[model samples]
Target: MSFATPLPGPDGDPLVVDCDSCVVRSPGACGDCVVSVLLGPPQDVVALDDAERSALGALADSGLVPPLRLMTLDDPPTHRDAS
Candidate 1:
């Protein structure tokens, strides 16, 4: 099964998965991702590419933190269609 995309890091660079939070399994945040709550004080934020970052911030400032939802799949019943 597939999952959500991975988060980015400050400097727009991807961090190494040094710990458990580094993985892309979690939808919220991760240590490796640039913008996430996983990091403690002095941790970096997830800085997306220039254009994307601007849009992301604008959306947040516009009182639309999560304007819309991305792809979401409804897990099928077990022992059903695997074809």
Candidate 2:
């Protein structure tokens, strides 16, 4: 069984996996794991525009994407001005 939608990774990149040549084949560590098969590994960061973000938000609202666990930091990292 394969995943319909791609799993989200760090920095908005989608994780992809080729189950055919996967190391964790049947009877392995991830033998009966769905999440492990679907979510392979974080590849690259996807830069999302406003429209894309809106579409993703809609998909999340409709329960297409799995629920995520978010962590909030007391002091978030500050970005330097590029001026």
Candidate 3:
């Protein structure tokens, strides 16, 4: 299966995923799945912006929405190696 295409955010920023370089590209749970956004550090908690919260609420209220799954990675892979 193919991965999900990243779309522009409300502010026109590109949401990107480099599936080709991802360590999880094969045999991982996210291999063929769509990811919404890349989050910040684990200790950081963020309140959703008004637009995001509204959109999420709308989607949740919609009957067409599917069950959601949340995944957290302790050490997420990066396309670039540290210098």
Candidate 4:
């Protein structure tokens, strides 16, 4: 049940990614997420540091890759349901 690895943010905070706990862990969401785009399918966890996050954001903004659509339970349910 390892949710996320300790990925340090810009300010030394941790950026945790718990895919299994995500409310929007669906095929559609997974297919369009930056993690999936860069690292293939969704795993139990996907860790990314600040630089990696920034790179993904830049890539997504430039339309080179999809944005990070990992909507966990702590976040609002903006994406569609898994069902």
Q: Best candidate, TM-score-wise?
A: 4
* lDDT over C-alpha atoms for residue 21 of model 1: 30
Error of 1 at 36 (Å): 11
Each candidate's TM vs. the true structure? 0.26, 0.33, 0.25, 0.70
TM-score result, candidate 2: 0.33
Q: Candidate 2: worst 10 consecutive residues by lDDT?
A: 74-83
How many angstroms is residue 36 displaced in model 4 relative to the true structure, after the best TM-score fit? Answer: 0.9
List clash counts for every candidate, in order: 6, 0, 0, 0
Q: Write one digit per residue (lDDT tens) for candidate 2, span 22-70.
A: 3333444343333333354323322444455445555555766532211
lDDT of 1 by residue, 1-83 (tens): 11122223455553323323322324443322223322332233232364665555465446544321121133233312211
> Number of the top candidate by lDDT?
4
| Candidate 4 lDDT trough over 10 residues, lowest sum | 1-10
lDDT (Cα) of model 3:
0.32
lDDT of 3 at 16: 31
Clashes of 4: 0
**Model 3 segments more than 4 A misplaced:** 1-12, 27-32, 35-83
TM-score, candidate 3, is 0.25
